[model samples]
Target: MTAREVTKADKAEPGSPEWLKLVTASKIPSILGISRFKSQFALWHEMAGNVPSEPISESRQDDFDYGHAVELAAAEYWRYKNDGWVISRGEVQYTDDALEFGNAATIDGRASRGAWRRIVEIKTARDLEEWGDDGSGEVPADYAAQVIWQQLITGWHEPANIVLWPQYGKPKIYSIEYDAQIAASILTLVREWNASLASGIPPELDDSITTYETVRRLHPEIDGREVQLDAALAHDYLTAVTDDKEITKRLRGLKTRVLDAMGNAQTAVVVDLKIATRSPARGDAIALRSNTKADPATIEGISA
Candidate 1:
């Protein structure tokens, strides 16, 4: 990719009208079905302009704010640890010069060493369990996809590094090597997604909670009505519910057995691996309650 073939969109705030029109790096994980927070169906609907963008809850907004606040700190740490590396923290967005399929990226930071340039993505995590050892290239699939998408948009195939700030430790870096095959596959997927948008057909639904919530939001009315159901779907639902009850009962029995073996111990272990740890519920424990509503239904009927 050449500079002449790449166009920059200045100051395109996320969720703005201009940003919504383009498939940014952050959306790649959703499209690839690896995003922990978003489902492909939700992304498809939003990109198709069929529904309003999902609102950010207060807790989610706090997460974003924390990430934005420490972005510079993460970048600075990266520079401090890696000698001779210069980092640029700028709000720059990029797309193809031809604007093909409207793919875009707003990189968190850019790094350069002499003539070699690399994309630097900053992330904050509550824990590093989901992340791999530093420089292992074993980051979460969603985050890895985000970096690859950034590289694709920036036309920089040089390996990009993810600078992560964990809750309790100094930052760590994960390096992702560029794979042309993966980039091509992602590009094809992006093109197909755009084609689906143009065709006015949303992506098929998955069994993700995000997808289920999106469906619920799309149809929020609880009207006094009854509708026919497909036989197969009804039978499957019944079977799933029955299995869920049996599984829950078995799980409880197993937990009781494990606790009996542990007997006043706080930690459960097997050989060298830690299986589970029991800790007293504190801070916000009283407030942390399930939001799931009871299913108001009989075998013959259903309601929200």
Candidate 2:
């Protein structure tokens, strides 16, 4: 189904199965680094039309955790600001909610003016263990990109603050300033992704290998198996291969061809294709062969 059709039933009414399904589907993708689940939530919020600024407790755990983190951070800000620091709380419109945007993309939490003047996006990081002793307090590039994209969607001026609460220590606040150029570039990329998804075609993979690795690590069951690549892959690939154009092109072509073949096959027949990188004397070649129980004659006829 088209992204539009897939999202048609995504209205955010409390207790609705459609809403619940959207939340559930997003969980796997978000965890698997397949797509930004937050973006999907944001899109759902926009589609649902001005939902009340209350917490949706029945949402996914990861989402709920993020929301709680933001609220706690906001409360902390209130406490600190009340003591003399200038702090403000943005209205929590949809905590881990779904939002649809202009028939293009979906977003996660959609916050606007309520408690604070600007829109707030809350991201949680377990710890800064990855960054050893860089006192500069560097934020991970991926997390930074996420906040910038949210800024582009919400049109917020101030940099979105990332509340980094480690499991072992106190939370560290990281400020993410909005970069117009960067935000614009992200929007452009997202638009292209929307177009491809609408056509039932997956977007070109810029970092297929890295994404494959991430998916494999997160969902062991789906690893080494063929599955539909979604927006999350597109997003990660774009970020992963931002500098390598050649690999990106090849990966995109391979993904498209594979998806197209699968789309045409009969579901009852259960067609399976094994893709492996072969190092031939000439160069690298991808070998595609069926790995199913269907007879050779049937397979040949189907291919023909």
| TM agreement with the true structure for every prediction | 0.81, 0.41
Best candidate, TM-score-wise? 1
lDDT (Cα, 0-100) at 203 in candidate 2: 26
Over the stretch 1-304, how does candidate 1's per-residue lDDT look in tens digits?
6323234536456677767878888899998888998999998877766667877899889888899889978888889877998988754566766556666777788788998888888888753446642333368999888888888778788988888888766778889888788988998988888888888888888898878888987888899899999999999999999999999999778767776777767655444344554443556331111112222133124221
lDDT of 2 by residue, 35-145 (tens): 532333333332233222235555566666666756656556534533433333433222222344232222333333444433333444432333332223676656666
Q: Could you tally the backbone clashes for each prediction?
A: 0, 24
Number of clashes in model 2?
24
Computed on alpha carbons, the lDDT of every model, listed in order, comes to 0.75, 0.44
Candidate RMSDs in order: 8.5, 19.6
